[model samples]
Target: MEGRNKCAACFRQFNKMEHLVEHMRISYHSVHEPMCGICRKHCRSFESLREHLIGPLPKVDCERIFKDRGCDLCLTIFSSRNALWAHRSTCQFSRPNNAILYRMASLGIQDELRIDSSRGKAVALACKMVGGGSDGSLDLCARVCLVDEYERIIFHAYVKPTLPVTNYRYESTGIRPEFLRDAMPLKQVSRKIQDYLCNGEPIWQIRSRSGRARILVGHGLDHDLKCLELEYPPMLIRDTAKYPPLMKTSKLSNSLKYLTKAYLGYDTQTGIQDPYEDCVGTMRLYTRMRSLAHRTQDYPLATDPQNRNNYASWRQTELERMSPENLLELSRSDYYCWCLDSN
Candidate 1:
């Protein structure tokens, strides 16, 4: 043990070759490897190697588990039996017999609807329609419509603005106050829209009969609905403007002109977007790229409303009735399956 005459590991002395062999076996164990200094875990390879740092070594019982046809959860398919067991403990797919258990397992995942693959689903597109002047006398318009797979505009109308022009801010990017001042009021616009759609029966009735009302569509629709003073269910609204994924990316700009150019290959910067054309374009874009997601595999599409403090109290009450597992399973599948298959 004097000077450099000792073994590099364990610093044990060796008087002869056989003594050193005995020292190595006893101190390091015949099969057991040295424990890593960092994680305090056993390592099979030399510490200097990069593989030793990241790669996990096979456990002694790994082969036996597979040989005995052991639980897939305890096999060597994953890094550790513990990890595999943990995943199996929560995996809905692992339990095919128990519906309740399957549903409960799905609760850990996200809950977002997916698109169907059979027949294409319809997309609804809406947009704010404004035509006014700088003076208080201005007209605000709102358009809500349904579009088809072929990028055809089906139902379209211009609703009147609920509030006066003075109540609206023109300094915003899309607001053209001066033009709005000279335009008609929300009442006038609503009359025009009602006249157009209700001339015979309602277009909504016709579309609903033809099953076109369930189409997938898009727009900066929330503001449009507000301007129109329309109250519809959240499912009826698929506003691309509020979709976080589209907003985070550069594919669609906040401005209609930019969105048209980027998505529909049309430049609306020169003049006002025809309400019908804007609606169609937004729907086309939404239909084209609605499958993309930004989150990881296990990330929930919608957070639990019960845990959110800012949401309405009624939201929690409604959420309490929904089983998280069922929502998660629905989110994992195609969102438009029902629409496409609803013959």
Candidate 2:
């Protein structure tokens, strides 16, 4: 009979116990790795995980159960048939109404939103920058947009840059000289956005996640905030560009345009880029990631006291001797799983 020492992630078996120990040392298996919702086996990416679950020559047991329980969009498995049906509504989102954009534009959402972050909902932000400085080489904030989960514009405005505009980048932004003549000044606009985002939470309380501070979602938020001259709490921000699981296999950030097309199955930024549209796209991506269903972890994170020192050199010898099943049983996620956000 084959030895019981099998790697849980790759399912590789080794005759010698020492060989399995070396393999475990090299393999960086964790909950972050896309995993089979049924068998709990870790795979490299969602693409490979999809192949494992539903592709030709799939595992008989997993394929059978997944057929009924799995979500086609996120590849999550619900507890029951009823659960799967309930999840479909969330998994499948409706397209945002373009008419709302024109209506909101006329009203000028204008950063007057009252945030109640006690709701723990995330909002998406996007900005458009025009060129400043000699030869139009510097970026100056020209427009900004913020949207809620329902794709409702909470804030949208053309920002008058602090510096003189040299290039309007009209081919992309469609901003004309007249648009900024009466636009919100950058100082006033940034302050209003900052206040709205802070939502009455003090700086200290924001990081503790104990206050009503909103969780800001966006792509390249650092750049957006810099352009706007605003700062937000790190913990209260979710930038899709930096989220590890969303990155390319090469460990580089994927463009929002590419991510939208690949995951949301649509095209964006084909012509004049609308900040509202960017806001909607980023919002959809954020919510989609937050909606994933993973096994509720007990020692939820790898940093927990129970698993924190598991990798210490002193414990290495002991870990190597444990059965493969035992080692995997102790494995935990290195990062906080976004599924917890669903609660």
> Which one wins on lDDT?
2
TM-score of 1: 0.36
lDDT per residue (tens digit) for residues 1-343 in model 2: 2344434423443245445544544554665578788998877566567678888568888989999888766778889999999977755654455655645554544556566544346788999999999999899998888888877778888888999999999999878897888889999888777777777666666666735667789999999999998888886788888886777655588898877876676678877788888889988988877876666666767568876665566775686578787776556665565666777
User: Candidate 2: global Cα-lDDT?
Assistant: 0.76
Q: Which stretches of candidate 2 lie over 4 Å from their true place?
A: 1-28, 36-41, 47-95, 99-111, 117-120, 208-210, 311-326
What root-mean-square deviation over C-alphas does model 1 reach?
A: 22.5
CA lDDT of every candidate: 0.39, 0.76
Per-prediction TM-score to the true structure, in the order listed: 0.36, 0.76
Score candidate 1 by lDDT. Answer: 0.39
Error in Å for residue 287 of model 2: 1.5
* Candidate 2 to truth, TM: 0.76
Total backbone collisions, model 1: 25
Lowest-lDDT window of 10 residues in candidate 2?
A: 6-15
